[model samples]
Target: YGPRTERSKLPRVKVAEPATPEQIQETRRARAKAKTETPTLKIEHKVPAAERRCTVCGRTDLTTIGSGKSSFVNEYVSSQLVREEHVQEVLRCPCGSCVITAPGAPKVVGKGQYGASFLAHLAVAKCADHLPIYRIEKELARKGSPVARSTMNELLHRCATIVEPISKRLLDLICTRDVVLADETRLPMRNVPKGKSKTGFVWTFGAPDELGGVDIAYQFANSRSGATPRKLLEGTSGILLVDGYSGYNDIEKVSSRRRAACYAHVRRYFFDSLKTAPIAQEALDLVTALYRVEHEAKEARFDESSHL
Candidate 1:
């Protein structure tokens, strides 16, 4: 009876209703003050002007000499070039004997509408920014450029061709490297015809050899067959850090091989199976323990630098 009386004596509290006008105005002012207290960020882009001038005497004086068929007096000079806005102009000299010619402006991309810097921006936007070409074309139109998607495609193709030499050299470096990591990811080639789901594969190889720095190579292929690894890594040797993909097994000829699997991949499979598989929780616990070990290793300088 005493416990029941004490429980009944306890008071109940109610939740507050909507704020009054004064409180609302105060809240709005507080928010405005917070916004004013924060700093604003601004971005700027600058493009350098293109110009040409004389190397010697630093004078703009120039003259054109051409190979007008020379019998003995009136001669045409082959050195004469068609004038354009890109071509530099100089003050004409009376005598055609000595002509100080300014070399034509260097082109980032030759003949094509897009410049070198523009191609670079486009590549970064596509690869890093994950923007599709169609979106980029729309953006260009918004900026008054009105660039076509086909033009963008041509630009990308030309850029890829131009950089192929560097890419090949990097691939060669990767091939020579004793330590390497190789993997492939699927890319949907949507341009292909219907019912043909053309699944393209992107092969990435990385790490360095006796030469110097790390080199990465990416190749696109129509197939992701086991033989794909064999084709890309022919005559390659040493440690190949990769995911648990059976396709890599076709390249067993790799010398002094050591396989290090991605722990994240193993964790992902166990996590996905956790709902149905009773043993999945146990596997997850083991993976969590491994991750804790990795975390501890990262925090504490446990291993010697050479062993690391």
Candidate 2:
């Protein structure tokens, strides 16, 4: 379906109930299982006992077919979120002196209605997957966790507020690395003034060799200025890889940072000149040869630190 026009009411996700003693014991005894690399969800449809009969002359007798044939086709499974409702106990003195309520689960956002898992799912779907909020809203409605798009957006903003410190810490750590690549892209602001649209830039800095699954920090600005990148490259005494952007010149001037130009940008100039000038073909050929050597080296498991 196309974009939804009507403001539909969203249904709340199913609340989790308190587990029984037996169920709790069973859950505690459960062990972690290794996951399959290939497709694991194989839904096999079996013939019912009442219908498992010979097709010839309505005969009821049939021999075992030894695990009948199965055809596999990819299918979609909708994800539904469940809410964990914690029912805390309340204690009061007989003399009505004081009352106390038991503590609940840790909050991702203080006193937040949604759980951390729900907030994480929404953040990944929107930020990582670039899924539209309306589509996410519709998906939730289709699955049983029907949450309003507005509510989801609000929760995401709150989640961001909670994660802001973590992101800053990651970015600070990345900046301290000896090598970092930085790039920027234009972003269209949706909730800007209605008369005219406003544009912002999203800058990302990554230290390619940095591990431990932490991401590079990003900075967002309304204007594309050298200050935005200078701030990101602050205290970066190592090499900085970037595209053909003069904004980073200030970074090289102020700091003892080794600025490395991207080969993709260098090749693009020759690539565009190929149509107008024939001499550019030789440069393109050399670039292609260089890329082939790099590819070969990668196939041979060669890294920057690898010798020979």
Best by lDDT: 2
- The models' CA-based lDDT, in order, is 0.68, 0.77
Residue 215 C-alpha lDDT in model 2: 53
Off by over 4 Å in 1: 1-87, 97-100, 191-196, 208-215, 254-256, 268-282, 293-308
**Which ten residues in a row are the worst by lDDT in model 1?**
1-10
Cα shift from native, residue 169, model 2 (Å): 1.4
Residue 141, model 1: lDDT of 74
Per-residue lDDT tens digits for candidate 1, residues 79-196, read 2112346756665578866666677667667765556677888888888899999998877777566778988888888888898999888887776666778888888767555756
lDDT of 2 by residue, 1-308 (tens): 24533221221323334556875665555522222234567667867988987777888777767787876565666568877889999999999999999998888777877887888899999999999999999888887778988899899888789889999998888787888889988898775567667888999888864343435778898889989878767666999889979888889876779999998789778777767886777776676667666765654457777764
Give the least accurate 10-residue stretch of model 2, judged by summed lDDT. Answer: 6-15
TM-score of each: 0.60, 0.71
Q: After best superposition, candidate 2 residue 81: deviation in angstroms?
A: 2.3
Model 2: how far residue 111 lies from native, Å: 3.3
